[model samples]
Target: MLQMLHEKGLRAEHCYAAGIASIGAAFVSWMLSQRMESNGIARADRWGIFIGEWAPTFIALGNGLRTYEK
Candidate 1:
């Protein structure tokens, strides 16, 4: 997968940027859900947590891509 990603021109910097963006997106989604839903803060928290989980995967991918680049 890493090889494929590298071949596709996905650099470590891209993944790192994605990771940071996802974190911000997660926070935004949480706030949006909180304001728009009746399920309240719990639902918002879950939304935040779910999106927040993607950051690690992106960061890990960034690391893997860095390795491949080397």
Candidate 2:
């Protein structure tokens, strides 16, 4: 999968950047949900946790791609 992604021109840097971006996005989503929803903190926490989950995947992909780059 990493090899295929590399072949498609996806690089480690891209994944690393995405990981960083996802973190920011998670925070933003949490804040937004907290502010906008009537459902309160639980919903906000869920939103935050859901988006936060993407960071590990991107970071892992970045690591894998870095290996392929070698």
Candidate 3:
């Protein structure tokens, strides 16, 4: 998908970077939740999962855009 976006002259790099960043954020959220002293661990997990969901869409959009360009 990234390759297709790159070929289509879209800034696939940024899309890829955003996906990576989202995953990082999700990981951090999960870690923080685990380290928390309160009962917010589940909240943190949910937040991480929610944020993690976005990565795939961004990737898909990038891929779709690339395919459309082609």
Candidate 4:
């Protein structure tokens, strides 16, 4: 999968950027959920957590891609 991704032009920088973006997205999602939904803090927390979970995977992928880059 890493080989294929590299072949297709996937890069570490892209994953790093996405990971960073997801961090902000998590905050945005939480705020939006808090204001736009009537479900309260618990629901907003879940929304933020779900999006925040993506960052680790993206950062890990970036590290793996960095190996390919080297």
Candidate 5:
């Protein structure tokens, strides 16, 4: 997967940027869910959590890609 990502031109910087973006996205998702969902805060929390989880995966991928780059 790491090799494939590298081959596809996905650099560590791109993954790092995605991880940072995901954090912001989580906040936006939480806010949107809170306003739009019937379940309110609980739903918002879930939305926030789901998106927040992506950051770690992206960061890990970034680290892996960095190794590949070297």
Candidate 6:
């Protein structure tokens, strides 16, 4: 996937950056949930998991863009 993105002109660096950002977002979401009084631990965990899933999609998009660029 990295190779394909490179071939298309998409940089691995961009994908990596996006992945990092997604991770950060997930972390923030989790943290916010943790602070919520009404939602509790289970809610926080669910939110964290949901946000966590976004990281992969961002990474995949980045990879696809890179491939296309190449």
Which structure among the candidates has the greatest TM-score? 2
The better candidate by TM-score, 2 or 6, is: 2
Model 4: colliding residue pairs: none
How far off is residue 44 in model 1, in Å?
0.8
**Candidate 5 lDDT (Cα, 0 to 1):** 0.96
TM-score of 3: 0.67
lDDT (Cα atoms) of all candidates against the true structure: 0.97, 0.98, 0.75, 0.95, 0.96, 0.76
Candidate 5: clashing pairs of residues: none
Which residue ranges in model 2 land beyond 4 Å of their true spot?
A: none
Screening candidate 3 with a backbone cut-off below 3 angstroms (N, C-alpha, C), the clashing residue pairs are none
Q: Write the per-residue lDDT of candidate 3 for residues 1-70, one digit (tens) a residue.
A: 5565567677645666788888998898888877883776778788789989889977776666655545
* Candidate 5 residue-wise lDDT, 1-70, digit = tens: 9999999999999999999999999999998999999976987899999999999999999999999999
TM for every model, in the order presented, reads: 0.95, 0.97, 0.67, 0.97, 0.94, 0.68
Worst 10 residues of 5 by lDDT: 35-44
Per-residue C-alpha lDDT of model 6 across residues 1-70, encoded as one tens digit per residue:
6566567666756776878887888889888889974858888888888878877877877766655555
> Candidate 2 vs candidate 4: which has greater lDDT?
2
Off by over 4 Å in 4: none
In lDDT terms, how accurate is model 2? 0.98
Candidate 3: C-alpha RMSD to true structure equals 4.7
lDDT of 2 by residue, 1-70 (tens): 8999999999999999999999999999999999998998999999999999999999999999999899
Q: Give residue 54's error in model 5 in angstroms.
A: 0.3
Clash count per candidate: 0, 0, 0, 0, 0, 8
Q: Residues 38-65, candidate 1: write the lDDT tens digits.
A: 9789999999999999999999999999
Q: Which ten residues in a row have the lowest lDDT in candidate 3?
A: 61-70
Error of 6 at 45 (Å): 0.7
For residue 61, model 5's alpha carbon misses the true position, in angstroms, by 0.1
Sorting all predicted structures by lDDT, with the top scorer first, yields: 2, 1, 5, 4, 6, 3
